[model samples]
Target: MEPQLLHGVADSVATVVIHHPAKRNAMTAGMWRALPPLLDVLAADPGVRALVLTGEGGTFCAGADISSLQGSPDEAQRLAQRAEEALAAFPKPTLAAVRGHCVGGGAQLAAACDLRFAEEGALFGVTPAKLGLVYPAAATRRLVTLVGPATAKYLLFSGELIDTPRALRTGLVDEVLPEGELGKRVAEFTRVLVSRSQLTQAAAKEFADGRTDRDAHWADQARGSGDPAEGVTAFLQRRGPRFTWTVPGPGSA
Candidate 1:
């Protein structure tokens, strides 16, 4: 079967499955290219309050399909960069439901999500060191932001696989579940998340996202954006805000 992104929805959560389990759900360049448009669909769909990214056949994702690494290195890097941008900037909340191996590009993909829920058996690593490949700076930044400089350095430098417990301790996985219960647990958690207000979530995501960069003008820009006004008004009235703001589309606008 052709490697494909399978889409399924459950109780307002959109699940994007990477379906190439024979290779441990390893992602190809085409699969990387496919993520952005799928994310766009999920973001625009009012019914999809949260998104789940997982892989088929127990394994979350092994990494890039190195078997197909015959392309121009520059082209591959460019495409991977674009895909990473889409995943990082996707509006609304995203959860990575992981199991088995999550290494290299697979780990990068999961790190791009807002939260990661992994089975106790899952493994995570940044394996560029092992493969003699350079990890992209943006992906490195995301990993650093999640686990801090010291932990990020250890993972990137060693290229060793860490178990689920170590991953949680390092803030790689937000939550861990027992083997068979991972799917059910992820579903329950996602449902609870979607029940909350999107406006609050969006603002929280924005604020938290900008926190890493320490943008000097973020305060004034945020206040002038009108989002805070709607937020305050909705809170005072005990009603939901009609959040009219939209993030910039993929690629330079």
Candidate 2:
């Protein structure tokens, strides 16, 4: 079957699935181009609290479809990079629920997500070296930030596949689950994310991604949103905090 990017929302969590099982869900050029617009739609929807990126047929993505690599590769790589940047900058929480092979460009997409959860038997690799290609600078930097310079070098230089345990040990993956449990675990975690204050999560995501200078507006937002007051009152009243702070769409000040 032709490759496709399939998406749906349930319980406020949007799941984006890469579907191309015949090639282990390798991403086609069209799929790469389709991603940014889809993410924009989800990002602008206030009801979509989080996103989960996964692959169909028991595999995550194997990488860019090699058949499309025969000609000029610039446009394909550019589209892939654009999609990766969109996922990285998504205003709300995003998780990559990975299984099976996640290599090359597939690894890039997973690394772009805010969190990664992998099944026990999954494998990961950054294989630009094997293909005699240069990995994108932004993606390399993101990998370095997640696993540090040494591990990043190890993956980029050798182009070797690492299993789930080693991936988790190197901090490449946030969690490793049994084969059958990844979906349940990811769903549960996103539920926790959905119930939290959006203001807090968005600010924390920015800081964790290396924003050192505090925007004066974050402080003003905290006070004006009443989240702090509601949280404190709910704690004292022995009730769950009803947080209603919605993240403003991109470019809203």
Candidate 3:
């Protein structure tokens, strides 16, 4: 069967499953190609306030299917980069529900999300060094931004897969739950996110994303704009903040 990008919506959240269990949910070229548009639809849908990415079976994603890369490294690399771009550039809050092995491209995928939840015993690594492959620029930046340059370099250069606790210590995964509780934990987390204001979440994500960069435009926009004022006012007045500002188009910002 062809690899699938299964999608569904729950409450105000959409879930994207990378379903390729035979190979531990390793991503295929076609599946990678299909991602951005799938994400675009969710982003444009008013009902979707958040999105979750997970893998079929017990495994999250094992990165690219190396066997599929035989004579098409260039094509494979381009497709992978495009997929990473899609996840990284997605406007709404994105979460990666990780389990089992997350290596190479899979790590890249999880790192692209705004939040990452890994199950106990989950393992993470950037294996490009072992494969003698150069990590994609965008993916590399995401890793650096997540755990800082030193830790990122340590993972990338060593090609050593770290356990869930170590990964958590290094900020690789935000939350690590018991293996069996991944789905329930993710559901609870998603529900919490869905209940909150979409505008505040979006602004918070935007501000966090730009925190490492020198430009403070995002900070200025969030503080100087009327959104925070409205949020505070709503809080004091015992109402919800009506946030109307959305980060441009799906892939624009």
Candidate 4:
């Protein structure tokens, strides 16, 4: 199939599938360009409480379609940076459901998500060093934040692939599932995410990302929201709380 990003939403979850199976889902320039706008649409949808990014098949992504970077490396790098930033800025929870290889730009995309779940035997790498490309500062900092300075340096300096165990140990992936169980775990976990209060999730996302100024704003919002009351009532009644809050606006948090 032609390289593209396939999108879908169901049960409050939006799934973006990177499809370039001809090259193990390597992203093309066009695919990189498409991500921000697609994410905008999903973010604006009230039905979308969370999102999952994954590859089309066994391989998560092999990196950029090298041809996309052939003529103008700067342009390709800029596209990737923008796409990565968009994912990081998404208002709701975002998860990267990964399998097989997730290297270079693929690793960047996965790192952008709030969480990453990989299958056993998956291989991951940060490979700009191999291409003699300077990784963007923001992406580098984000990677460092996820895996710590030492582990991040190891990956960036060597451009060598690491297995799922190493990725998990370094905190690069949140969970490592067994083979075919990745999809099941992802679906099960996202359902739990959707069942909870989006208000709490949105606020927590911003806070976890290091926004210290929003504490007051979130406090006021919590006071005004019914989620807290419902949560209490549900606990007393022994039932799931019916959370009614959605994000107040798009492109927030």
User: Against the true structure, whose lDDT is highest?
Assistant: 4
Against the true structure, candidate 2 reaches a TM-score of: 0.97
TM-score of each: 0.84, 0.97, 0.86, 0.97
Q: How accurate locally is residue 110 in candidate 2, as Cα lDDT from 0 to 100? A: 99
How many clashes in each candidate?
A: 0, 0, 0, 0
- Summed over model 2, clashes come to 0
Per-residue alpha-carbon lDDT of candidate 3 for residues 65-172, written as tens digits (9 for 90 to 100):
888665667778888888888888777889999989998888988999999999999989898888778888878888988888998999999999999988888888
- Mind sharing the TM-score for model 4? 0.97
Clashes of 3: 0
Which parts of model 4 have CA positions greater than 4 angstroms off?
Answer: 251-253
Tell me each candidate's RMSD, in Å, in order.
3.9, 1.2, 3.1, 1.2
Task: List ranges where model 3 is wrong by over 4 Å.
Answer: 211-234, 237-253
Question: How does candidate 1 fare on TM-score?
Answer: 0.84
Q: Which ten residues in a row have the lowest lDDT in candidate 3?
A: 244-253
In candidate 2, position 39 carries an lDDT of 96
Candidate 3 colliding pairs: none
Candidate 3 yields a Cα-based lDDT of: 0.84
Give the higher-lDDT candidate: 2 or 3.
Answer: 2
lDDT of 1 by residue, 156-217 (tens): 99999999999999899999999899999988888778766564576678677774553444
Which sections of candidate 2 miss by over 4 Å? none
